[model samples]
Target: MRLLIPYINAMIKLRLETLRLSVSGRITGTVYINLSKVFFPEETWNDFPLTIFNWWSHSFLNGNEGDYRFMDGPFYFKIIKKNGLYFLEGFFDRKLIVSTELDIDEFQCSLIHNIEILLNTIKKNKWDIDANLDIELLNENLCKLKKNI
Candidate 1:
């Protein structure tokens, strides 16, 4: 059991990061104000269904900054300001997960960062939508965004 722990952890990390990239699609260049709202909303996980909402609500209620868990693995996040721009960064077990730069100013950055963090957490956990939820529209929107990118 002890020997399998490392392998299990690595597999989980790979799957989670792959899902994150799939959802976020490796943003490049500067994200303007208009696009920022679309890509990184006030609640990034709002588009997703109930599991994500549970995760977000738990995180929000706990107020656990810099340290969180997804799929039983530890993760961390931070909102960084550099050159008058904001960046939302994610890390898994001290390894870099993603560093997304936002064009928004410092004032509005935290809200976006909070949402991004939650969204990433949702992706990391591989939460699936329930059958009752209308996920087609969400999939369509994500497809459109991917095509635009």
Candidate 2:
């Protein structure tokens, strides 16, 4: 029994190490995915611009470590587009990362490719930027002040 326990622990460690290596190492950045702006003006339903119907950042990362499922986190947002493409910008982890204006009909495909590349690039490049996560985190409190009209 003792021998098996040690083996199990070793396997778990190895698996975790493998996952870490497979993903970009030390990848910490804010990722922004805009849903409607340039190409999807009519598609922009409700007041939320960046977010689709239920696809909040808190629920976006189904497989990522930051996936909060139902609990709303500070990182989730839906920006208002006044003129140009409503951008989704924030300091993720610590690095400044931005998503291309996502109005392409095939957004699902582009999103996967873009995020994969962005995370890898940030992980490899190790950019030094202001922490935007704090802003998102803080927004949670201020958002309550808005009138429910």
Q: Give per-model TM-scores.
A: 0.27, 0.23
| Winning model by TM-score | 1
* Clashing pairs for predicted structure model 2, backbone only: 29-92, 30-92
Runs of candidate 1 exceeding 4 Å displacement: 1-72, 103-149
| CA RMSD (A), model 1 | 15.0
RMSD of each: 15.0, 20.5
lDDT tens digits by residue: candidate 2, 30-94: 23233332211112212211122123322323321122111223332222233643323322333
Please write out the lDDT profile of model 1 over residues 3-72, one tens digit for every residue. 1111110000111222322333321121111222222211222122223323433443333222233332
Best by lDDT: 1
